[model samples]
Target: MRNLLVFCVLFSFIFFNSCGEPSKKKEENQLEEISENDNQEKSESGVILFFGNSLTAGMGLDPNEAFPAVIQQKIDSLGLPYEVVNAGLSGETTAAGKNRISWVLSQDVSVFVLELGANDGLRGVPLEETRKNLQEIINTVREKNPDTKIILAGMQIPPNMGQEYTSEFRNIFPELAEKNDVHLISFLLEDVAGNPELNQGDGIHPTAEGQKILAKNVWEVLGPVISE
Candidate 1:
């Protein structure tokens, strides 16, 4: 009779443990699933992406001084529900921007600011190629997020590139904006460009002060879109 009792207790212990093991594993799996969903939800939230070159990168200044960061500050103050992602890379050309656009678009984007082609124009890259690359970049962004609001930052190259080339380069931004039906910032550097106080020693990238102006330029158009 003792042997029978011992067998029954051992069976009960084994059965309970076996049942508990699956329950523990299921709880762990559920927690893991919940974490993944939370991460995905966070990523899908509204994102304002600034994809461009050195000017956008804030080369000579701190990252926080970058126009995109400045824009973020404005967004925060307004209590807007958007995050800014500065994907700027120094010396980035239209072709390079186009090439890496897919990777940038992988994340959810509510607003996309395109600030490219300046380097391409400076390098004397073919106008047709530059236009084509810019167009493709716009197309890819639209394809990735059909509802994303696109803002094109127009840039001007030095006159040394010759009157005709410079004119054509200057015209690209507006042309592309018109074709794509996107908002355009006529001149990104407006009051900042050519001003030694606003630019770095290199006379190219903007200084911290210059970036503030740039941010305002972006915000003028961006604010309306986000408010909507």
Candidate 2:
């Protein structure tokens, strides 16, 4: 049935990314733990958590190639006082993200970029459910830290799911951003999507060159927020 098919798709998507997991710790995580002696060194970095799915995790590519890592490199170049944590799960839906968000927010976050719901849209998950789950995630972030700046990455899917469904899915990101009063990325994929050269053989995840574009897209909105 449809439920089984959805599960299969999710599993396959996750499996594809699982192949690249050994390098995640080395490339995606940038938390700094200064020793007491080093505490005098100064510069306590706040965390910038990038929470989402495969795209955020940089599936099919090196973790360093992911946009979040790219953002971290940018932050380092400018000497920003923030660490970037890539919490992207390949098969994550908004509902799945909600279940794990509390633990993820255990550390204080200066900026949170949310990039989920693409899997939901692809699997034809109910639009209302997707919207509600995303709202909950946003709410959880605010509750965890009232001062944490949020950036919601917008996602869009093809019309294979019908015009109404596709349109509703596309609108979820901006509507939630407006309703929650947070920064919005407009379209996370932007120029990267639907471009054959920019994507992998799967024609979904972006290539290394494409990730550079993704980094640019995120920096456009993120640069100002972190700089502010």
Candidate 3:
């Protein structure tokens, strides 16, 4: 009888241990599944890169106050899966932008917004040079990924440089947009450009209010493209 009781106890212990092992293994498998799903979601998120000068950078304002950040807010509201990257640098000419295009293209870009040439125009760079650099940048982006959508932000400098030069500068954007078949943001600073209230004291960078308009302008073009 004592031996029989011992046998029964050993059987119970083995049964419980086997049951517990499967439960623990099931829990670990569930955790691994959750981890894989999280990684898949992150990898699926697309990147929208806004590459340009201080206008894109929001030079004088808080980083979040930049137009790209504002656009991010809009995107979140719409439940979009794309991420916005502000690659704007202060005083970035088309040449500087060309130099860094490769580095910036390191990340997979679903959409590429080009906002350079403003600094170049302001500084009186030759139109041909500006056009060539812009084309090269566009080419680099295409070479990296032909699927990337390109948007050219049209910029206009005051006629401080003769009207002929200013007109040609303005024309360059449309021409590039046409030649490369990229979308164009007619003017990055439409309603805010000459508005004293919208711009900062420098009359160049937009104030917070000005940034709102810029965001609106971009959305006009961006909304349609993304929707497609």
lDDT (C-alpha, whole model) for all candidates: 0.89, 0.88, 0.91
TM-score-best of 2 and 3:
3
lDDT of 2 by residue, 194-225 (tens): 99999999999999889999999999999999
For TM-score, the strongest prediction is 3
Query: Which numbered prediction scores highest in lDDT against the true structure?
Result: 3
lDDT rank, highest first? Answer: 3, 1, 2
Q: Whole-model lDDT, candidate 3?
A: 0.91
Clashing pairs in 3: none
lDDT tens per residue, model 3, 1-228: 445545555565567678874344544555566667778877888898999999999999999999999999999999988889999999899999999999999999999999999989889999999999999999999999999999999988899999999999999999999999999999998999889999999988999999989999999999888878
Q: State the weakest 10-residue window (summed lDDT) of model 2.
A: 26-35
User: How far is each candidate from the true structure, as Cα RMSD in Å?
Assistant: 9.7, 17.2, 9.3
lDDT of 2 at 4: 57
TM-score list, all predictions: 0.82, 0.83, 0.89
lDDT of 3 at 185: 94
**Candidate 1's residue-wise lDDT over 74-97, tens digit each?**
988988878999999999999999
After superposing candidate 3, which stretches have Cα over 4 Å from the reference?
1-22
